[model samples]
Every structure is written in structure tokens, then in C-alpha cells.
Target: MAISDVDLASLLCSKICHDLLSPVGAINNGLELLEGETDPVMRDRCMDLLADSARASADKLKYFRLAFGAAGGFGEEVDPAEARQLIETLIDDSGKITLGWALQNEALPKKAIKILLNLTLIAKEALVRGGSLDVGAEKGDLGIEVVVRAEGAKIALDDAIRSALDGTIASADLSARTAAAWMTRELAVENGGDLRISSPSATELLLGAIVTA
Candidate 1:
């Protein structure tokens, strides 16, 4: 169930815009408030709000550029440190979620980098109640293995996303919410890789992908 390239591009753009709407809207609102505020203390508070909103907007753009666009410099491989920084920024405003990154100094191929970033995005969304996300990768005899684990008080995975990642959902049914998951699966398959999801426990969700070099 593959979609036309145009359709895929449109879907991704919609996803990014939707994710950014909140913080961007806040920035606009903050500007309006600042324009009307007269008290010194109130004006300072509005400025703080604007700063936070601007940071969040920038973070979202950085995360999306890696996950949905090309941003890792022109190369066959992307630096793992850059990926870590992108993920950290992505979760900065998503409550008290801690990240555990453990990847070798070696770089990952462009395809693997995309898969990793998309999986990281999905895992971050699953931890609505705020939790720990551990991302690790290693190149082995089998292939490049990427694992993203999420554990929190409430780990809720939407059924649509689960099916999409498992390659059971139809392309026509894919919405912006499940678009990234579908894209992740597609990338894995194109690279002789596979995506898997462990039967999440009461409070844990595991996403794994393997790409053969």
C-alpha cells in the first residue's frame, strides 16, 4: 500500500504543521498580549512566554528536518551526536521525559538515520505521561539494529499506529498521525530491514528496526 510521492509529501507537511501549530500559535498570542501589557512585571512575563514559544518552535523544526527532511549534511552517514541533540530538543517541552542514548561513535547510514529519528518521534509521542526513552543502536553481523524503548506511568499506543508499523494497515487509511510510522516501515523494507513492536507490557512500549547494509 504505497502512496503517490505527491500524497506522501503532502501528508508529511501536514503532520509537521499540525505539530508546530500549538507553540507557534502561543507565540502569536504572546505577541498580542505583550503589545497590550503596560505593567512592567506583566510585560516581563509576556516576554518569557514568547521566548519559550520561540524555543519550542525552533526545536520542532530541528527535529522535523532530521525526521522528515534532509538536515544531516551531505554524506552517506550521519553523526550519532547530531541525532542525540535533535532528540533531546524534541523532548525538551514534552514534560519530564529523560533520554538514554547509547550509540557507538561510528555514524549511521542516511536510511538508518531516518528510521531512527522517526521511531524516536513515535516513541516520544507514546509517553504522554512523561517517562524514560532509551534509544540504542549497534552494527552487527546481521545488520544495523535500532531499538527505541518507552516506559512510563501510562504507555498508550494507538491501534492505528500499531497496525501501521506492523504493515497491516492500508495506505489509503493512513492519516497524518500514522504517517511517520508507515514511512518508517517503508524505509526499513526498502533497505532490507524490518520493523517490530513488542507486545507492550502494561507500562512499556518497544520499537525495533534492523537495516542490512
Candidate 2:
């Protein structure tokens, strides 16, 4: 099945909106509660909730802007530190998944950065029961290589996501949930590379990608 540019764009937009809805909705709810409560103590609590929700929403937007939207200006290379910080904040908000980072690049091509972020996102999602996520990337003469490993008491990766990342899923079967995986795979292919997925055990999942500049 073939996906047009418009379809891809719509799917990505839906994915972003779906992921952001929770925190954004919390912000709205906090506002409503704060407006009705007159008690000082309860008001303070509502304010705290609003603050946290706003922060969460902001963090997710930053991550998605780089991972899915155009960020880091029009420069060919993007600073790896920016990507790292976004990933750190995203995982920190979860308070469930621990992140281990080992990016060996001062800067990477924009496409490589997006792929790295998306692959890491997918790996992080595999930790259904809260676990460890390790992300690594390196640039070599051939291209950039990224590896993301997730290990936990229970790792659950939807088969559809696996198919999307491996370029086996038909476009007609794609959904917002799998949009990131599909975009990551397409970006890798566009950059003269491919993605790989492996499940060494039920408790572990590994995702790898190699994309050339």
C-alpha cells in the first residue's frame, strides 16, 4: 500500500495530538479545579498540579518538535546535546523508565537525529512494566549508527510496530500508534540505511538503525 504525503502528515499530527492529550487535558482540569476552590491549601495543590502538567506538556512538545517536526534550524547538523536533553526530560517525567545515554557524536545530520530519537522512543515504549532504556549512537565513515535497548521484567512491543519499523506493514494498516515507527523507517531508507529489531528474550528488545548522511 502506498501512503501519500498528506496521509503521512495527518497520521503524524494525530500521533502528536494523542500523546499530548493527557498532559494538556490535565492542565485544563487543573484550571477548572483551581477556579472553583477557595481554600488556600487546596488551591496550592491545584497550582502544583497545573505547574507539573504544563512542564510535562512543554517537555513532550520539545521532544516531538525535534523528533517529528523541523527543529535545530535549517542547519545540516544538529547538536546531540539538545536531543539528549529532550530525551532525558521525557523519560524523567515518566519516573518509570531509566535512561542510559551514550551518544558519541558532537553533531549529527538532522535525519540521523530524528531517527535516533524515534528509535529511542519506540524502545522506551517497549518497557511496559517500567525498566531500563539504553540509547547509543555513533558516526563513522559509512554513516551514523544508532542502537536502543530496553530491558525490564516485562517488555511488550506490538507486532504492528515491529512490522512498521521493518517496512513490512501495509500503508492501509498504519495507525497513529505506529506512525513514529513508520516515519523512522522511512527516514532511514531515505538516508541510505535500514532499521533492525530483535527480541533476545521476552524481557528484552533491541532496535538498531544505520543511516548515511
For lDDT, the strongest prediction is: 1
State every prediction's TM-score relative to the real structure.
0.96, 0.95
- Candidate 2 off by > 4 Å: none
Score candidate 2 by lDDT. 0.88
Number of clashing pairs per prediction, in order: 0, 0
Q: What would the per-residue lDDT of candidate 1 be over residues 113-211, giving only the tens digit for each residue?
A: 889999988888889899999999999888999999999999888889999899999755798888889999988998898999989576999999999
Whole-model lDDT for model 1 versus the true structure?
A: 0.89
Instruction: Give residue 150's lDDT in candidate 2 (0 to 100).
Output: 90
lDDT of each: 0.89, 0.88
- For candidate 2, the C-alpha RMSD (Å) to the true structure equals 1.3
